[model samples]
Target chain A: MKHAAPTRTLLALYTAMVAFVLIAPTVVVIPLSFTDKASLTFPPSGWSTRWYENFFNDPAWTAAFGNSLTVALIVTVVATAAGTAAAVGVSKWSRKRMAKAAQMFLLAPIVVPSIILAIGVYAIFLRLQLLGTLPGFVLAHSVLAVPFVLVSVSAALAGFDDRLTTAAASLGADRWTTFRRVMLPLILPGVVSGALFAFVTSFDEVVLSIFIKSPYLETLPVKMYASVTRDTDPTIAAAATMIMLLTTVIIAVGLLSMRRKKIA
Target chain B: MPDKTPGAGTRIDVKNVTKRYAKSTAVDDVSLSIEPGEFITLLGPSGSGKTTTLNLIAGFTELTHGSIEIDGQRVDHVPAHKRGLGVVFQHYALFPHMTVAENIAFPLQQRKTPKAAQAALVASVLQTVGLAGYQDRFPKELSGGQQQRVAFARAMVFNPRALLMDEPLGALDKNLREKLQLEIKRIHQDVGRTFVFVTHDQEEALILSDRIAIFNNGRIEQVGTSADLYERPASLFVARFMGESTVFKAQVSSNGSDWHMDFHGSTLHGPVTSTVPGKGALVLRPEQLRVAESRADAPAGSAAVPVQVIQNIYLGSGHKYELRLPDGSTGIVRTPLTERTSLRPGDSAYVHWPAHQGVLLEDNDLVSTT
Candidate 1:
């Protein structure tokens, strides 16, 4: 039962303050979601579940939520599979400088400004006549999501002993069997976390969603933006709070699994 | 633990195997003919291609040129998995998520052995490695030495053709390393399987190998028994690598029946193995050379040179004296503690060796001082 030193206590307090500042916007929306009033105001005169009800009752809000969920699920699957494969290939095959340069090029979507990427994607989708389609949004979101998955899986691969695969092969396991038995299990945590990151990135994406949204097809973030601009709807607060909750749960799951891995 | 043979031994013939990277050669045209149940150690300094040769033999690395045959069947083109060989790496490389039994059962599972047979084999191997009750423990739960035993058990449980170990005990502490060295030797003897061990430790090579292949600059310098290498080295490199020696750079002068070299105005005679020589190094082992206070005390016909003792290091059983010869070159002489008086630093002494013990290697600088 040793007390913490003053410097350690101060450091903890400073970190808490910074974290509160960062999460203040999301925390504000959570309280507003339960306000009795129709306006988005803090410390409401009375508290009620009206905004949550408003979010559930409106067809537009429900449709937007449904669209976001479907798109994010599709993006997570597509991006995780493709990105994990790419990360493995980069780690195994790209041992030379030119191939490594090619790997960096493939990860460019994560580094480029999203507004610029939105412009480019919008132009391409316009000519392809995929502007308002689900596939178009899924494709754009997957491109943005691929880099997060790639980075995560690649870091995991770096820690993974390629010698394990060699050892497997020497033990009479074929290439496919070695990959299935040795490589996949060791890197599954990375793949899962990458999938979660991909889902969150796609769910919260606003710039690309705005660029490609049709009048009939609005994702949750796009719908929230419209509500914030067109009306001070408290239901938008409920949507934001729900979106934040989803991401927090996903990230917490990732962190907890990582901690368990360290302990194990 | 006892002499229980589990698998048939393999005769590996590496015929002129060569491996090249983009910028350099990892292994040159090296060939070795290993018997069915012989333990051969590939001994060299790091980057001398000992491990590369082992990898090539294990079918882990593809040969740039040449071929290999196992049991008289050409296997140069076979993939590592199909070769049915066992390889133990420097690091244990144990699968952390697997239990000890599962790790040992991996090869049996791969070969589609029945579940009951797999369990029996895993249990037997666990006992063989002296980890009988530790089957349920994961690799992460074990100590470094325990993990190493698990790795060794996993590799040998399959009972493949030959076991290739690449510095397997390099990461362990001294005591554990010595203990495992004996374990590995006992296991090799009990199983009667061909073992190709790669290690940079000369003492380990001497202790374990029936024959040691000395590698230098991607080529096998010499291959012989420890006594053969110690008593008669083929090259200056082998002589220096096998054990400690003081080298004398001199010109050989022969008179039909006798050979001699003039060192610091004293003409010393020795038997000549090589007649055609320009400049050669006369290599004398520390035990072969004796240090005496007076020149008259040196043996008759022995090569004698005056040396100034620089440092005297007492190594419990003996004293090692670092000396500077009159010509500015350095040398070391070891004297048994019971046989001689301890010489102090800066004392003048005569270093002499028997006439027939000096081996002349032609102009090869074996040791790089830098």
Candidate 2:
């Protein structure tokens, strides 16, 4: 292909740079997850599933994974419900200035620095006697997930016709019935995507969980982090590989579901 | 018919209602009383407050200044769902989740009606809206026109005390709009329910309204029948708004109990008015002007305006003549297609009106610039 000088140079430079930056680390790590040796050294002298077996076989690793799953699920449920409800309330009051303020408040979880939220959550959880408890972590994560839910559901609610509720009200239906029968179904796809985001956020979170939870109630990220800090091993690499796999699947599913809704 | 029996008339009485939103007055001091079985259309341009009037009657907005009485009982504080007034919006606004049957059954369900009776009512209302076989279909599966029928069914299912339509046909294409207009008229006739419709389209208002309330700026400019507004408009706005007309300045003088207007350097005697006698202008509808061969001793058709035909526009039904007089003030003369025997560009002709055809207005021509 004949190429202009700048375009050809940029394309070549971007391709090589992307390959070095993205593929290099991933290529070095995947094989390490299956290393027979205990050390995290690349170009391993042997190959086996010993690290994977150990990660699944050890009660501590499995328990931490289970705890992470539980926290993510609870956060997803609470965030999706509260965030979708907020979306509907704001949609009905869409054109008003107050609705705009409520929307900004909902998205403040994303806009404000995570450190501030972590500090606030830590302080509140301590007073509530919920420090180091699973509920406290889940609630804090759900607050982080709400902005995602609000954004997704708010996008869906943008195209919602306000007159639909008026039409329902003019008929025999009350406000609650109108929301249940009319608004919920239309906004379900966005809510599901938001819920998936909630799941992913809490599942993969490294901060807040690091500060708030105890050593006994360590999430998968905290456990893997603690293991890496104390010593470098192929087991930590194995856990990292699994977490990446789970997150990739969740993100892919959320994107596909949203796309399917749009097409339909 | 309602006037013939006591306690039957005056289905809706709106007494000096007003709605104000910070720094903007949406509806102001509006008052209208709709008789039972009457079709009163509030007609005006956008933001003229007709839609606000309908919303007030439907209990959509809280009235700031006045009370709304339905059947002589105050409904000013009633919530929209409890007002018991059926409403059809501009958009079809069909519930996306529900099937046609479910949407229609909603109102019945809200009232705690029995299940079997609710089904029967939903079926009957669907039939009334001409959606008999589409009961199981969801709103998204139907066309725009079908969705509108479902909206109609949903609105009328509860047998509301009155009906309010806010430009219900505003979204449809022209053919569908005209078709639905007829269907709405038929439904109104069959039900004989008082319908207060709000629309800015004057032709739609004229065709559907028993009497129209023409609104402007936040108040009712005039309220009259279609013929009344077309034939004898009260003000310049009403006269010009109702239909096409060609108006001219005339200096009038009284001659032997007959008022004559001086036009084109000639005296033309026409209808005598009880108002001021000095000077004013005469307004003529384009259709009311005629070309007469004889303008002799008959003082009624005096001062025939000698004009050169500039252009003739052929409307499908008739011919519209763009004629220029000696003065530069432009006006149009409408003639039927069958009578275009000698009329064309650059033809000499005299345009005159019968005495009764002209309506006299004060010669305040400066205020009539638009």
Candidate 3:
């Protein structure tokens, strides 16, 4: 499928344009965070690390950062456990139509508009008197994060042989022992990736968090949204850069570990 | 029975076992008693309930009717893991993530065997399967035959009451399959445990089994030793399934002393071994048939049919001839190299067999829908 010279040139140009468009915003934010200017202006006239200093020193930013990390970590654990169980159960269901319906239900959060879910959660949280609470934010973010876990774990289970479980049982292993000894070690790669996805989903959530956040409990994304409207500073760019770096490192680690497992 | 020696075999009794799905019956009223220390094979084509019967006995499948007993104790309520039977699947379902040593040690660990004893048992069983010093390798690293041997070692390490195998050698090439068949037979002899093997290859079944049970249409058509199945099949389906046969569909008429059948226009006489009336077939094995140059050269008092030699295949120890009978149906005749005849393609000859060598079986080939 080699292309003509002119066609190959055109294809390379198109690919480069798409890549620049996708990466420009993130790339620009990194440089803007190092600017000496107080405002977030691209191609800054001077360079400094004052914004990074402000991002680390400010109590509001620090609290929001800590809150975000805690929620993301907790959501990762909860969502990974629930989603892996759901995936295994759905894979073993003998009634295919019912299994398909259950899968669609688990994935509905990813397909439905975020605003609709935000409004629905806000109304329910208001009635429960949980509008300004940590549990409220954790609950909403977990609802959005679980689908990522489910998809990754289900993909892993798809390649797993169902006969291995039968083989385990014939060798005198009970259901729990078979799962812990045979099934888990095989599907661990999927579970790890799902946990990382869950962490990023909760860490970056804003729309649902905006509906549920309180003055006392604001995640990093919610605080960033408030900052952009109330102030014009390069500190927000520093925060964005940090978030990008954290997720990229997490994803890279996940991919490397999965690749190593495959090689082994 | 409860005090039977460990590592010794246990008798399995399946009484009128039937497994019925919603649409069709997989195993229908199949009853067989397997003796301890006997190697029995469930021989049938695909979907003929041989594997299903093995699964039923393994407790992986539930029997819809009747019961199964191990050592005279009913086990219909037992789970697969609790039944303590070793099972080797066709694909050698070894745990891919585990090393060979760990895979074989899994059953011992499940039984709460001590750590030191588990290692000793795993090593001993691996050596028994002739896979010593290959313990650290993963299943994917081993060849297909090696993986199957590892599977065999894993299934046997726990000293189960009996061993059940479902076409364990089916995934290998013909040469490896034959080689492993001998290894499996030797292992069976060394263990002296009851083995219930399932296979569709009749030659493999005959080579390995102490007794073979022929399954057809979810029923046990016949159960006998290899010689009993090959020489004296109870029905036409058994005769056709066991080996190659030359069949003559005829109307069976019996006198007080002998049985007679009309083949084309000639009358053939056989001993009245069974009172098979009406439609029947005179089935003779290929070796039982010989090709003579003419009717005058056929043996005295032998039933002979005029045929044209279509092709004569030279076997190493004998010659096999493809024959065209008078009714256009093909027949086969095998003669030893010592008795090589002048028969060649396009030559007129008579395919003859001793009257006593022909088995007069009921014409019930249609009994098996598959």
Candidate 4:
């Protein structure tokens, strides 16, 4: 499988080009966030942490950050529990065609256009008087995040041996006990990765958040969108940098847990 | 080990239990009454209802008809977890996440046994399976044989009344399988619990089971001690399944004294055993047949068939002759080295056996199709 020297060099160069394309935006934002000038200008003449201070000092920005965290956390919990249960149920379904249909239905939110989903949710929330409410945000974000959880959890369950469940039952474990003692612990890596995915999905969501947001209850992404139109402050870049850092850490943690499970 | 009195095992009665799927019957009206403290093996090939019957007793599969009773109480409606039966699977379904001690202690913990007592029981069961000092090792850390020993320890740790094993030694090499077979037999003797085992390997069944039930096509062909099945098989299927046999399709008739079998073009005589005989199969075990130089050299009053020696195999302890019969079927004959005749390959010979030893069974398509 060893490549020729020229081919190896070409492959390394191609990989580096792809990596640069993916990382170029994050590199620009990180440096732009530390610019001394109020305006976002990458490769700045002077460097400072003024935008970072501004991000922490302004109540609007801080409130939006807090709101995003709250919504993402709630969405992670709700979506992970619901999605994990759905995955387990689908896996245990005797009729495979029905199970596949159910799975495709659960995954429909991911495939359907976000704007279409946002408009539908907004209409439902307005009638229920839940528009711009925390519950409304949570419900909408959970809908977007659940499919991520389902995909990860299903991947984990795919590797699980059904005979272990049978073995647990034969060892005097009831259904719930078997789940708690054997199935849960075995599939915990998948659940953890799914939770991480749910958090990132909710945090990074913008199109749905924009449609549903009230001025008083804006998420960080909504605030950043609004800020981009009204001003050119580097503070938006700071927020973007932090979001990148948070998601990168979460994804890295998810991958590490998955790798550990593989090694075990 | 303390010299404790053997615990009285539970009796399991499978009363005409049948399990039918949408298109086929997995287990046809099969009934077996297992005595307390008995080591009974359900022996058959794959797809033959033996494993289904084991699952029925384990309460894993619901019976479509009839009922199962354990200790005289009907348990057909009970779930597997509540049936209190230990099952050892063919692949050794030990929990990879748990240590040896933790795996063995799982059932004890389910029963809410005291922590100290659970540890003692795990240790004792591990010792019983000969894995005493490997408490903290995970299943994947052990070899297949060692993992199966751990599985056995886990299944028996809770002292279930009866243990069900479905080819527990099937995943091991032949040497390890034989070793574990002896270990399981000794464990059964020490614990005195009823054992219901399932295996396609007839030799393993013969070595370990006090009684063996032969299954074919979702039915129990015969249930008997190994000797009973070997010496007196009830059907052609049972006779062929139990051991290596040379079968001759024959026409059976009685002469008011002895039964005669017209095999191919030769007449072979035996005692009258079955009265309703028309077409029959004469089955002769390898050890029962001897290769002689000629018809006159065959033992007196023995039935003989003319055959050509195709190959002579030296088996260290005995000599085996591959024979080509007149009907284009192959026959085998095994003789002790002390009784080895000066027979060579390509030599014409007479394969002879005592008339009483040749079992004449009813011939039917049931034996040929499967």
Candidate 5:
């Protein structure tokens, strides 16, 4: 076996160093979250799980956590259904020009600045008198999450062999039966991965949540933001750690399922 | 394996069917009547409308004009799903997620067959396709040939009125394809169903079909039994497509029932009569033409043309001698290895064939690029 050259090794070390610098804040916060001291200090004194207990015992934190989970669940269901349908429709468009245009329009949320999108959504929700409601947050988050689902489902659709549908039709299956038996199973992984992505997008979203949040209806991110600005509480680090852990688990499951599908 | 499903074979009538795209016609004014229990092959090159004609009959594509009838009932307006035609695509199109048993049972399930009946039918189909114990293997787990067998089983399990195959064996290796071709022939014989097969392979068509329809440029040039198309092709295209042959340009003249053609300068008489006087092509199959040492040794009354050999190719069972004709055109002749004649490149010889063996195609040139 041949070892890498010195220059290549240096380049790899540089990339790892850059990655560490980018994620340093999160790494520091995790350990601080376990600190026994009252203030947010890393490697300070002994370690404890007091902040985690604080997160679990407090009613405000628990309410924010519940609110975030509910909104993310709603967004995941709405976005996956609408986005998967849109992907199938877009994949079926005969005219290349129309399909390309529709794809660009559907993916506009990903390219637009988040703050501008938040303000625009806030304005629309206000006019609809849904600003502080659960539906408003769910709808607003779904707007951002839909693009991820659409992209994931579209990628799956790209590799689909349409002749199976024709074969199913010829074999005495109606259109709906063909979709349910053949098309759905083939693209299920894409639909599932897209739904997970939509969930994660809604759960960690803060910019839009900040704009639409009411005092009575705060998501985890909005509450964390308020805690950081109002008080120098270390419990914010615990909240960040929990959100990170949730996203990590979701992503890990998504990757594992995708790998299993590939192997199968 | 017994096929208990009713109505295995159905007569299909395609009356002047035409399918036109915006830019060009895929199938144009084509008509063919396929008998029940007959295996008819649509043979042509890619983009020559053979597959399009199959699709039209299968109701996958709507006809631009004319009608199609299945078992004497018009079905041009029926959708593909309601047509109940068994179609096997070139790529197999097996559902990757389904086990072989489930795939074969799909049509039965759709028609609401009882679970016990579906299981029994799937088992029977698996046995019929020679994959009796592969019930739980998914499509992705099977080899290409096994997948194709599963596809055939799925298409046949439902006992559709007619089976339409579009280049089903095009993807396999040569040995596997030949093996599967024999399997298909056996299955067709056992089932006794009408099969409309499409392929670009002339040899496969000749070997497997009772009748072969040769398509060229969106139209069927000719449709007949393998021997009919091979021996008495109606047009220049059919003669060129069916097999290898050498052509000579000649001028036709007739005396009532007898006909004679004037080659470059030599005159030859044939048993068939020519109704008109004009230039036509004299098609001679390589097997019919023999190489003689001299014009004097050639068969009496046979058309003999002197040529010089360009190359001799050893073909295991025989030898093929490529020659340059008197008119400076190329010709090929296949001779058995047992023949005593010794020929080599640059050797001078006369190629002779009986007058009755040559076919005169009117208004045809000796060569065609299409």
Candidate 6:
């Protein structure tokens, strides 16, 4: 094997360090989940399944996990449906002056800061008496999720001919049927990816969840934050480990299913 | 597809339809009735609105004015899918996610045909398009021609009212294009469905269409059978567009029944086909021009328009030479190229043609520089 150059060696060293800086926290949580000692730190004296035991014994951690899954699933379903419709509507705009103006408005969610959107959503939720409710939290998460759906669905629409939809309609497919059989199956990859992004966004949401969530309505991330703030607990790390594993499994399933579908 | 097109008889009346793209009129007011079971080709160059007219009929693009009726029912307000028409795009938009079988079954499935009947219909169409066993293959696995066959099978699956094809064979290679063109014609005869095909290729339109609507600037310049359009083109644009024609200016001195063309310091005689008697151009096809050793061997009253050969290209059976007249009028002439040839570059010769061979066209500024 060829030896790396001196400058390249330095670059490789820095790259490895940067990766460690980003990945170290997540990696630390994994080991801390199994730490014999009840603390969040690396290089413990001895390793045991003590924290893993804490994870299973505590009902708070399990309920948080359940809440996070419920909210994320609802958000993913709602956002994907709404975003696909909005994208399909926008895609039909004729290449004209008015169409451009309308398109920019639909894509505004992506251009504006998420924190700004979160603040606005919280304000609206407070007025509607929806704050601290799971539905409100799901809706708030969907704002962020919808943008991903838009991006993916738009990408799929770009590759499709508008005539195909019309052709479907001409073939005696009603509007809903045409969307189901022709447009949906044709753009399935984009729609599936959109749902994936929606799930991921809602599942990992922290900032917005903290603003809108009540003590009882707290998601896994919110509960973990509260537990960490109250005092040191290695159970938080175990809970984090479980959440990451769950997310990974879901993403892997969606991707593998998509691949197999394409092959078929 | 057969659903909209009755097997016995039908006529598609496109009554005064016009489509506009914002301020630009891509397709001006155009109206023509396609006879039942006839294959009509909309022939024009790019931006001539031939494809736009097809889209209007297919309901892909809504018309700004007028209406379209198939066998006498107004279809202008009908959405594309509800129009019950089959369309084949130029790029062959086969659903990439579906297998050839699934693609063919799509329209039938949309119609909710029984699954068993759908399988048989798809199978028959596959065999008809010569892809019986390739049904399981995705569009990507097939070549351009094979994918085109799949597209054809999908379009005909539901047997809609008519087949609207937008330059369907454009993406295929030369040999495949001709073969597919013949296949499409054979299918047309077998199914006896009306087809409104769009294309810019003149040869394709000539070979395929029973009648061709020659479109120009979003309007129908001429609509006739291939023979009628080729032999009796009314407009100079139609004459120049349909096929190659050599044109030279002629001054008309009278409006008599036997109007004469005073051209190139020679008087060429032809009937006065024009009622608006004035200065015109005498257009003659290259095949109409002939070369003789001398005037002694020429026919009587043959207008010997003197020309000098500037360049000669020997093309096996014949020689094509760019002939330059003294008045700077230039045209290409094709004649038999043999060892007995008497013409060469810089050689002076007289150009002669039959009187009826000359067509009088208005001296417009639209002479194509291309």
Model 1 TM-score?
0.87
Judged by DockQ cut-offs, the docking class of candidate 3 is: medium
Model 4, position B249, has a per-residue lDDT of 79
lDDT tens readout by residue for model 3, A1-264: 999999999999999999999999788989998999989787998999998899889999999999999999999988998999999999999899999999999999999999999999999999998886888877888889889999999999999998999899999999999999999999999999999999999999999998899999999999999999989778999999999999999999999989998887
Per-residue alpha-carbon lDDT of model 2 for A1-264, expressed as tens digits?
899999999999999998899878866777888888889877888899999999999998999999999999999999999999898888778378999998998899888988888888888888897877888888888888999999999988888887777777776567788787777787788888889988998898877788788866889998888899997878988998898888888889878977877786
Off by over 4 Å in 2: A1-20, A23-30, A43-53, A88-105, A111-113, B1-10, B112-115, B138-141, B249-281, B286-288, B293-350, B353-357, B361-370
Docking class of 2: medium
- Candidate 2: what's its TM-score on chain B? 0.86
Better of 3 and 5 by DockQ: 3
Candidate 4 lDDT over residue span B111-206, tens digit each:
999999988888887777788799999898899999999888888888787999999998899999999999999888987889999999999999
Candidate 2 residue lDDT tens string, B11-93:
99889888888787877888887888898999989998889888888877777788999988998987788888889888877
Q: What's the lDDT for all of these models?
A: 0.88, 0.80, 0.91, 0.90, 0.88, 0.82
TM per candidate comes to 0.87, 0.84, 0.94, 0.94, 0.90, 0.90
Model 3 ranges off by over 4 Å: A1-10, B1-7, B313-316, B337-340, B366-370
Q: Residue A45 of candidate 4: its Cα lDDT?
A: 85
Q: What's the lDDT for residue B230 in model 5?
A: 82
> What's the lDDT of the predicted structure labeled candidate 4?
0.90
Model 1: residue B169 alpha-carbon error in angstroms:
1.8
Per-residue lDDT of model 5, residues B59-127, tens digit only: 888999999999999999999999988988889999988899889999888888899988998998888
DockQ of each: 0.70, 0.55, 0.78, 0.74, 0.75, 0.59
lDDT of 1 by residue, B1-370 (tens): 2135644578999899899998999999999999888899999999999999998988888999999999999999999999988889888988877899989999989889899989988999898899999999999899999999999999898887888999999999999999999999999989999999999999999999999999999999999999989988888889889989887776777876667777667676676556636666777888888888878988777778888989888899988878897668788889888757557899998898877777777656645331
Which candidate tops DockQ?
3
Better of 2 and 5 by DockQ: 5
* Candidate 2 residue pairs in clash (backbone atoms < 3 Å): A172-B107
Error of 2 at A7 (Å): 8.9
- Residues A1-264, model 4: lDDT tens digits: 899999999999999999999989778999899999978776888999999999999999999999999999999999999999999999999999999999999999999999999999989888998878999999999999999999989999999998998999899999999998899888989899999999999998999999889977989999999999999789999999999999998899779878977786
C-alpha RMSD over true interface residues, each candidate: 0.8, 1.4, 0.5, 0.6, 0.6, 2.0
Q: Point out the worst 10-residue segment of candidate 6 chain B by lDDT.
A: B1-10
